[model samples]
Target: MAKGIRFHYLHRDSGNYKKFGHRDFSNPNNLTVEEITQRIRQALIDTEFFYPEKVGIPKFLFHRYGDDFSWYEFESVEEIQTHYLHESIEGFIAKLLRDG
Candidate 1:
């Protein structure tokens, strides 16, 4: 009963996309959303994608597909460090670009 989560990020210059995820949940039903988010954040940080002076918060999104197909948009480094729920990344980005 392992839950799956995937991370997608776009390279600003190259316009290429990168993806990552975990499949073995060990007991997805027992895990909370916060725990899942923490693991995702840790994995991204380990990749040096959140370095302040370097890349900062990479333009990334996370998706949990299947029964619970959801999308998450990373706003900032601080926001990613905290736990939150998933929304539509594409919609969020569109709104930001349109409104701001």
Candidate 2:
């Protein structure tokens, strides 16, 4: 099964795009990836199913030329492209901003 996760996104003034993921906290406001492994110290006090211990950003994403820049799991890449064909330029802008 595909693992799905929601991210925290910070928008821009032009409403062009919003950046998300661990980058929002660690990177230079760019793309970043974090991997966490859960650990429970005291099962009695901690009711959470999982408690993550490690938190670090991916090295490559913030780089100008990185794999993530070329390809990312954008929520709505296709819909924005379609709007360019069927509507005005603003319509394309509208669709692109809807991405997460």
Candidate 3:
């Protein structure tokens, strides 16, 4: 099986970046029409897991399979599979269950 990918989901508690601070979505360069649409679509979804009061949205920061410094924002983990040979943690578990 291929190696799994590493990613960090950014929330309020994450370290502040130079421009966007802890919220990458706040950056104009990072915001997209798709993201705006997604926000509205997921607005009813609970965010208490990452925020105290459904305040912040979960944003994925994925890095290249082996390189730590190559982090990039992606809409979803499944999207990463289209570009890299790495798999998500959920995918890893599913494969294990099927192959075992």
Estimate candidate 3's RMSD in Å. 14.3
**Candidate 2 lDDT by residue in tens digits, 3-96:** 2222222212232344443221112122212221111111211322111111122322343332322222222111111111222323222223
Best by lDDT: 1
Candidate 2 residue-wise lDDT at 50:
17
Q: Which stretches of candidate 1 lie over 4 Å from their true place?
A: 1-13, 16-24, 46-100
Better of 1 and 3 by lDDT: 1
RMSD of each: 15.4, 18.4, 14.3
- Candidate 2 accuracy as lDDT: 0.23
List model 3 lDDT by residue over 16-57, tens digit each. Answer: 331121222222132344443344234322421222123322
Off by over 4 Å in 2: 1-68, 71-85
Please tell me which predicted candidate would have the highest TM-score against the true structure: 1
| Model 1 weakest lDDT span, ten residues long | 73-82
Candidate no. 1 TM-score = 0.24
Candidate 1, 2-89: lDDT as tens digits: 2333334332222223343221112224345455455445444333233221322332353233332122233222112323334333
- How far residue 100's Cα lies from its native spot in candidate 2, in Å, is 6.4
